[model samples]
Target: MAQVSLRRLVKKYEGDVQAVKGIDLEIADHEFVVLVGPSGCGKSTTLRMIAGLEDITDGEIAIGGVVVNDIPPRDRDIAMVFQNYALYPHMTVFENMAFGLTLRRFPKDEIRRRVDNAARILDIGELLDRKPKALSGGQRQRVAMGRAIVRDPKVFLFDEPLSNLDAKLRVQMRTEIKKVHQTVKTTTVYVTHDQVEAMTLADRVVVMNNGIIEQVGPPQELYHNPTTKFVAGFIGSPAMNFIPARLENGAGALRLHLPEGIVLPVPPERTKRYAPHAGQEVLFGLRPEHLTEEKPTDKANIATFQVRPEVIEPMGMETLVHFWLQGTEVSARLDPAVPAEVGRPLTLAADMNRMHLIDPRTERVL
Candidate 1:
């Protein structure tokens, strides 16, 4: 219903702690944009500013093309679901969902109609008469969502709403939230430190770090073609494997020197990016999925390595192999059906076409 835009937004504390450093983002109408990062990375601050919950130290914030930097939180017409649920303990599910409208002095019939509709849509109609104390954790979360839905705000903001639930319930609610968004098509901005949730729920993901916006893109694009080291490491589960390698040769075809007789033969077409850094130290990044146990069938570009296996974990369909490479610990995804032995030396093959080259000096992709 509303498109939110942040132009050079900034927030600074009294103690000179820069909470959010000049971040600019545009979230379109009906788009589910997720702000994700590590702890104290300014993601929540940015969300608060958009919701009018925090004062913007500098820059412009526009909602539906209207500048609302000076507006109050309630006047912003945004509904927020918090991590704590924040349900009234003594109130029944119906009252909890109707509280906002009642406070605004909406007619009794109108409040009832909205509450009933939200409850039905959330599949909590059966529990409408139950109190929060009598509901399970997942049920209470649904109640919280229903309460927000009843408000009928132009924009929906979720501030780590799934963090309070168990892992299984979190996954369930993640799906439910996505379904609800699809039904309502209200513009939404979600904030979380959980990469899995960010990747799964968002239409576009904004990766933040150290009070700055590191990268923003589709989940798969950010995962496969990260623009920086922080993004490459932060956006994926188990993180991307970073190994220090030196470019050993010149322009035509750059060859990277790796430990233990391992060499990465870069394709001629991709050598242009590494042309300036030939013979310089660079970081090689490869996601766990890009490294496989299977032999390379595509001879176009392949990099081989030797890893001393430290841990073997079977995740049903895939096995996770953790090992040490060049004094750094790294993990790889492999076929679970393949027999893995602990403490055994394993040969890992990487699809060089999918490999990433990052500059250590700038931490940016080459």
Candidate 2:
């Protein structure tokens, strides 16, 4: 296992369109890092650059402490798993996994040992004699991964390896991949547009937008303490609710004045931090789970408000209640046992301690 580094890495196409802006990243040895973002965000380009498939327009890339900007992919000591499960049609799983070793002219015993070990690691020993056409989607993906594992390269690159699988299979394969990582402890760099996948598999997540990185941190850190509005809105499911509000100095304490006469006092701990932004128009941010059905609690900073539900969605364990505040729509999570319906006024509590205040002018969390 080895560390990877990118310094001032850049990728540009014709007409001066920059796919990846100059960015610097240091990936530790044996660390699993994920590059996540929307389409056209330069994630795939960055991955290909690291894999030596795409040339760097400028800047440098180093693998295992050696610069590899000019080295061909085959000599980069990296294995890549693509989305399409690029397996040989006529070759059996064993042959496919052993092909790389065979090309490198390894001893027959070494080839057999490596292939067998990889198959065991991937739990596909029984399918070794089967061809790609005879295997399921998940099985075929495992074969691809086994092929990579048999090489024992310095780094592993996965480009949306689960995109083609069904939802259930995707979840199952996620566990399988995590298990493989735990067992092998290879340095891994995975790229995908799915935030959940990034959060599930990454030790550190690099969130990219508009050809530049917006944030890089652990999953929960980015979720709870986003530095920018883009990171705040992109990292969560059902997304965080953003409402236009005016931050007011209510005598001695700080308060947020929302639409329709809904006002919530800021947590006492945050009053000092938000003091400078007082009397400014800021965006009030809260996740759906934090704004929930009113319940008895000993927790401080709980504020209550009433809103008429505009749309109600029953999601088995939790019901998603959506209401319109002026023109902005907001969502809240409630227990499924709570009776809910459209056009009914429901009381909900906002956990001020979990709230976020964002500057509307710069779109940065304040």
Candidate 3:
């Protein structure tokens, strides 16, 4: 096991294009940390730097309390599973898994032991005789992971290892990867563009944008209380709905004035936070799940509004209701039993206590 620490890490390219811009991060021993962001966000660059595959422009990378900035990849004691699987087509699964150990000159028996153990752990024991060309995409990925496991390195790095698999296979492979981690408990740093994978696999998720750290926290923390508007919008599925609104004083309380003469009172707990922004345009963010057709049990914390449903999608257990709010399309996760139809006015409840007020100018959460 190892604790990976990155201190002001930077990666600069030709023409002065900076890929990673002095980001500091720490990964605890046996911890699984995921770096998640959109394309061109420098996530892959950062991961490569850690793996010694890319030269760093500045700063330090320490693994297991040792600075490895000057060390070659083979000497750094890290195993990486890549998106392309990187398997040798000619080699059988067992040979592929044992190749690293063989190069390191482990005894023949030990190599067999390690390869067999990894195969059992990855549930690929029966397929050891099959070549990479004969295996499915998911199986090939497992073989790639098995190859990494046999090395028994101090850290494991995954660069979108599941990206090539189909959707259903990706989910299954996710569970397999989690199981593998629970068994090995090696320090891990995974990079992916999919937020769902980050949320599901990471002990802590690092959200990056434009080569900078946007937020770093447990998945739920980023989802529930994002520090920035970008995180609030990125961390959720169906994404949070942002409506143009202005905060205003309503008698003794605070209220949000929306277009179409809609008004929603701010929860008393959040009044102090929004008081300074009164009468100013702010972005109101609410998740689809927070807007429902049924009234919440806590009526005091819920506000009702009417909108014409523009689209209705039945998702078996729940219905996704799409409506236009102030000309912005918004989605609501409502109960499947709710009577919903396109072009029909629907009364929806917004969870006032769960709303987010964002500063439009700075794009920061209030």
Judging by TM-score against the true structure, name the best candidate. Answer: 2
Per-model root-mean-square deviation over C-alphas: 1.6, 0.8, 1.1
Residue-by-residue lDDT tens digits, candidate 3, 239-272: 9999999899978799998878899999998888
Superposition error at 323 for model 3 (Å): 1.7
By lDDT: ranked, best first: 2, 3, 1
lDDT of 2 by residue, 207-323 (tens): 999999999999999999999999999999889999999999978999999999999999989989999999999999999999999999999999999999999999999999999
Report the C-alpha lDDT of model 1 over 333-366, residue by residue, as the tens digit: 9988777788877778887888788889999998
Deviation from truth (RMSD, Å), model 2: 0.8
Q: Estimate each model's TM-score.
A: 0.95, 0.99, 0.98
- Score candidate 2 by lDDT: 0.95
What's the residue-level lDDT of 58 in candidate 3? Answer: 99
Candidate 2 or 3, higher TM-score? Answer: 2
- Mark the regions of model 1 whose C-alpha exceeds 4 Å error after superposition: none
Span of 10 residues, lowest total lDDT, candidate 2: 337-346
Q: In candidate 1, residue 156 scores what lDDT?
A: 93
Q: Identify the candidate with maximal lDDT.
A: 2
